[model samples]
Target: MTTLTRPLLVTLVDDYDVVLTGLAHMFDDYRDRILVSEIDANAVLHDAIDIVLYDSFAQPESDHEEIAELVANPQARHVVVYTWNFQPELVQAALDEGVHGYLSKTLPAKELVEALEAVAAGEVVVIEPKRRAASAAGLDWPGRREGITDRESEILALITQGKSNAEVATLTYLSPNTVKSYIRSVYRKIGAESRTQAVLWGVGHGFTPDHHRIDHWLGGP
Candidate 1:
């Protein structure tokens, strides 16, 4: 009988030789079922690379941007950020820039592997709650868009605008309580917990802050 391989290609991009070595060992320990590649940021794009787990500190901004654009291509399945001292907007920026998902170095390696496998299967491994909050934060809605109502869409628009609940209420002339309700629905739809994550979720689903869009919110533009 032939052995069917696990349909995932994993890449490790880190500047620290020690970290890379340790990651290599961990991947190797996983029965080699996962194909692991140790790569520098300069490496050319390869269709076989399904997920890229890269270090934020190792590469320069230019190189990182190049890598991000490359990962944005259809060929690269996902790119997970692994580093400390990440700014609030880093993950959302990555999603906007076209990467798949974000993970911190502090998370367990096994969960990271699972996330990679999930992304490889063409399913987004989400990290936020957006649907619930979206409805609560009523801002203003666009003409036509996703299945959500115009009012719900407006909340999303305000969310993408980086407006807090209080801000949304003030801008839309809605009670803060109503704004909070819309935000909760938004969170439920986007699977985002925090406002930043909801913004990212909005971006991830192509739901611009145009008073419209859907999906479990990850990040936004």
Candidate 2:
């Protein structure tokens, strides 16, 4: 008789419902290998999870307090960061926080599943995807439909959250000049001429962080 392995139980974390919903759909075809147990936003887990994949949408990166909190969760066997930024210092800091994985946002769904399996097996995985002009298919963010790239949308989200340019650079591991470039692009895309205007536009367009808990896929008890 042949033995069958059970799918790995995983939870997706992000501040936006759209972002987490898109991420959950990416694993639809790989249900045999990975089971999405929940889609949450800074909420505590009620059930045991093999991996907690924290999506760094608008939130601060590696050094953020939330990452440390997740690392200390007893229900989460392993904590991983799913982000677009992969500077060496950021990666090292995340590892130092006890994260099991630091994966790039550009990874294809299939590759992402493989990476999660590796993390579950106790391997420290850090994958920096090749430079790409766009995010992977099946992924969504706040301003994606408005012709904003994922990176630009992230900057807008941070700005909406009252992050200054210097703070944004620190959180994203981007240089000040690069951050300004992205801000300019976001301004053009959203028809905002000033930071105040951009922030107002962001506020009405789902850029503000959603603090309420969400169980998008698996209903909470």
Summarize candidate 1's per-residue lDDT along 1-221 as a digit string, tens digits: 12336535666665444344455555544544566665655555554566777754323322356556557556556776654324445556666776766654444456656666666666655443322222112111232244555456556766775767877765555689988887887777667788889877666554442212121111110
**Model 2 misplaced stretches (Cα beyond 4 Å):** 1-4, 39-41, 216-221
Q: State the number of backbone clashes in model 1.
A: 56
- RMSD vs true structure, all candidates: 16.4, 2.8
TM-score on alpha carbons, each prediction? 0.48, 0.91
The 10-residue segment of model 2 with minimum total lDDT is 212-221
- How many residue pairs clash per model? 56, 0
TM-score of candidate 1 relative to the true fold: 0.48
Best by TM-score: 2
lDDT of 2: 0.84
